[model samples]
Target: MANLRPISRVVQGQRMKEGAGVTICRTVGTSMLRNLDPYLMLDELKLPAKAAFAGFPDHPHRGFETCSIMLEGKMEHRDSQGNHGVIGPGGIQWMTAGRGIVHSEMPGTTDGVLWGFQLWINLPKKDKMCKPRYQDYQATDIPVVESAPGASVRVMAGEHAGTAGPIKMRNPGLLMDVRLAAGANFTQEVPEGWNGFAYIYDGEGKVCGTKAQPEQALVLGPGDHVVATGGSGPSGLKFLLIAGKPIGEPIVQHGPFVMNTQDEIQQAFRDYQSGALQRPEDNPWKGEEL
Candidate 1:
């Protein structure tokens, strides 16, 4: 029998304004959750149809990566490296701001509701100054597996079951989008010594016998596997199961920059201000403009 993980801590997302007056439900990076090893922050951006909100404009980042998963509507991304793309529903854009990069994520449609999640993954000290790159995928690019009756899993990164996700990162991790029908259950095996968590986004469910509500992030304790059961609601249950191998390094963050030391953080700011953060010649994005 697999050793089931227990819910170590439950963090309620705090609603706060971000970008250009857009509200976001932040689960990690808050005072309640602080930082989670290799994972830094997770934000749920939900813009209603009636809300007049400006999206995130050009911003700089360094020593980390940003993964954006679009669930509804569309988002356009443009970066200082001359990379441009649009992620529609079910699409994902993973950007590695290794040395540094300035990017913008704006809503592609103003008439529809926009919903998505952005997760920040920290890079180790060695890879922190590496070259910047992007790994983008359309909805069809991601592999989905129906592991059990009424349960569907989308493998976004790392391996799940016998299938592997398309994106590769400096650090090994798992980012799975799971959905369960009423009364259905799904089990996932996590690697030993990895930090993991689940963020419930729709309906209600149970993680290791603990009730999970929307916008709640449940931190998992040491175990070999995790179990999630769907509630009897019409929408069933939808959540993101994410885990990463801990970097075990000191984290010094200043706004969009994340580095190992205070001196590195200050250097990141100086590089951005001096227009020396990104190397245009080293840009790995070769796609056509959207």
Candidate 2:
């Protein structure tokens, strides 16, 4: 007998402007759902094809990791550590801003609509100052598991049906992109004490017993697994099921940086202002071509 997770609360994503005036739907880092333990923020990018966008300019970050999942468009990333890459549809770029990092992500497509999501995951105190690294994967690089008759799951971070994601991280977590046909059911095991949620993006569905719609995030309660049923719509349902172990530490965040204390947050600012946030010697990817 498996314990099914229940929907603790439902939060609708709020529209906000970020980076260089890029419109995004923010779900996790808002007043509705402040912070979810190991997860800090989740933003959905939906830019029109003909829209004029400035894109995200150079920025600094620390004490966390950022994962960009491109669903329909392309994004180009370049960091101070000399790591550069372009992730297109069905691709992911996972960057660990351990000690510190300065980077920029800009639109890589001009004539096509840009759609994606950026997730911010917190790092534990022990590995907060570790060396920064990146794990990028193309669509074909990731593993997909046929979970049910009409359900498929793309494992992004953790194991699913004996298949594992390509990206490696300091923290243990699960990031999955699930697609379900109409009336189909899907289930996945989640750690008992982990905090997690599901963000519906494509169609409507029922998470456990609660009705879920697009742009709605269902914060889950304690359980050993989650169960969901696809909507009756012609397009079916699509969502991102993300869960992670709790860091259980004080979070002090200032704009792009997140630390465990106010003093550390201030120090991050000082380091960035003094142009010493990321040391030159610490950049192993320097001068390497993408």
Best by lDDT: 1
The C-alpha stretches of model 1 lying farther than 4 A from their native spots are 49-53, 286-290
The sequence of per-residue lDDT tens digits that candidate 1 reaches over residues 48-167 is 734624788988999999999999988899888778899999999988888888888888888788999999999999888777878889999999999899999999987777888987
Tens digit of per-residue lDDT, candidate 2, span 30-138: 9999899999999999887346257898999889989999888889998787778999899999888878889999888787889999999998888787777788899
How badly does each model clash, as a count of residue pairs? Answer: 0, 0
RMSD in Å for model 2:
2.7
Query: RMSD of each candidate?
Result: 2.8, 2.7
C-alpha lDDT score of every prediction, in listed order? 0.88, 0.87
TM-score of each: 0.96, 0.95
Model 1 worst lDDT window (10 residues): 281-290
| Candidate 1: residue 230 lDDT (0-100) | 96
